[model samples]
Target: MATFAMSDQLLVIIDPAARQTDGESVRIAKDVLSAGAAAKVCLPDGPAEFARALGRRGSRRPVVIGDDHALLRAVTLLHRERELAGCGLSVVPVGEAGETSLTQSLGVPGGAVAAARAVLDGTERRLDLLVDDSDGVVLTGLAIPPARRVPAPEPVASAAGRWYRTLLARTLPARPPRLPAVPAPGPTRLRVQLDGETLVDLDEPLESLTVTPGAPGTSGGGTAEVEFRPLSVGAEATPLRACGRTVTVTGPDFRYRADGAVSGPVRRRTWRLAEAAWGLVLPS
Candidate 1:
């Protein structure tokens, strides 16, 4: 393993959902961090407290111990304060596998021990972000049509197991709850614009769309990738893909999954790439 010059200052924020869903994992992560570094752990029950914990952090490097939502909250907070570029964030995923997809995608270790060790020994990596006109931030890719909630796993067998599960349900933060999947609202006409060029006009009905950080050219550069699929079944009309610094999506009212959060029902939304706007710590 590559040894890093460990920074003594570290503040670990444990999300309530993480503590509720998998207290054991959170505890293991806490133990690892505390033993390896000068770690100060904070347990925030709600969003307000979460923000306050981060705001009060002094020179300590902020480490979030939770699922994707926890990481998103931290990144959004830093982005809004315009401190993202200089901050290096670390995360230890402590929820169900489905709930921690964002962290996994970003190359964070899945196991609590590994993730915690990475916090103390990882190298910093610069990453891009997507910022909307409303000042919202997207650390991971956003999807059109949004994502359907991952169905809960089958219940455990045996009476004793069932009782233990039930106890957890009542006592925990709620297993990082997911919204029950709702049927799509039907095909909607949308006007998709890349940079200033029109990709999908208002007359064209779109089945779905996705915007991600990356440029749309032979040379990969700073830009957002915009892609959409039309409802029409044309072999020649495969999914339309393009790259640009800005992408605008306008429809009657539609929802999108940004990072892991679902948002929308607005008539218009614009997203632009903020290249290397933030840094994340990954295993060296």
Candidate 2:
């Protein structure tokens, strides 16, 4: 990997929704960054603004001061802005205990002080990103089992009010929706192709068709990626696929879960991997 210079002035973006009760993590993060260097810790108005902040991050490195979801958003932003050439990402996992190391594995830490210290002395590594032109930036794994669509949210006035409702609407939890259960016969169909070669073609019910960064094409320039795990479940007609960087899917309208967030609906999509597109802080 080529060596790139790291930045000292960091922009901290904290996810406000995640810090409802024990909100002092955000304050600790703010103080840490402001102590030794010029820092700006700001709450993103929303996810779109969060991406915009990262896009316009300039020479200042981005140190996300939130949960793993915030880390995902920052990575997604980095993936979309491949022109950065080299930019380091810092993450402070201020969420539940389970996902502490989960973020660390990706080279981020959970403690506010520890993650902030990494911003000061962490080694940078070349990491891969998932990109889908059809579905936009890809950061995390995708799960597509049959799920009941969420009902439309009620209108709100104030930003705080809207945030509250959106938070509640999303917190409904992930379970088999309370609907009239019924039985059906026949399996779902999916035709998967990688680099124009057919990988799977069938009328079988699929649990998931996971695609990862394939090895860069011998002649064509791109990520060297492949998918090994294909978890097939019971009978259903809903096609499911998980793409890492780049993927191309052909069929009817297909609903996809990208980076844990579910999209409305779309079909005939392609995904591609962006490599070394973003920088991440690792433990020394």
TM-score of each: 0.81, 0.67
Model 1 bad stretches (over 4 Å)? 1-4, 146-186, 215-220, 233-237
What local distance difference test score does each model get?
0.82, 0.60
Provide the lDDT at 255 for model 1. 82
Error of 1 at 146 (Å): 8.7
Which consecutive 10 residues in model 1 have the weakest lDDT in total? Answer: 214-223
Best by lDDT: 1
Name the lDDT of candidate 1.
0.82
| Candidate 2 accuracy as TM-score | 0.67
lDDT of 2 by residue, 1-284 (tens): 32223346878887765566348876776777777566767677789888878777777777787776778767655655655356667777787665454476465666778777766667666565566764366543444444444544443446677778678679866545354434442333556667676655655444455544422211113453444233353334444433333456665556777655677466566666666555566666
Off by over 4 Å in 2: 1-7, 18-21, 48-52, 78-84, 96-102, 143-178, 182-186, 203-207, 214-246
Model 1 Cα lDDT, one tens digit per residue, 120-171: 8887777777899999998767887733445555544567777788887798
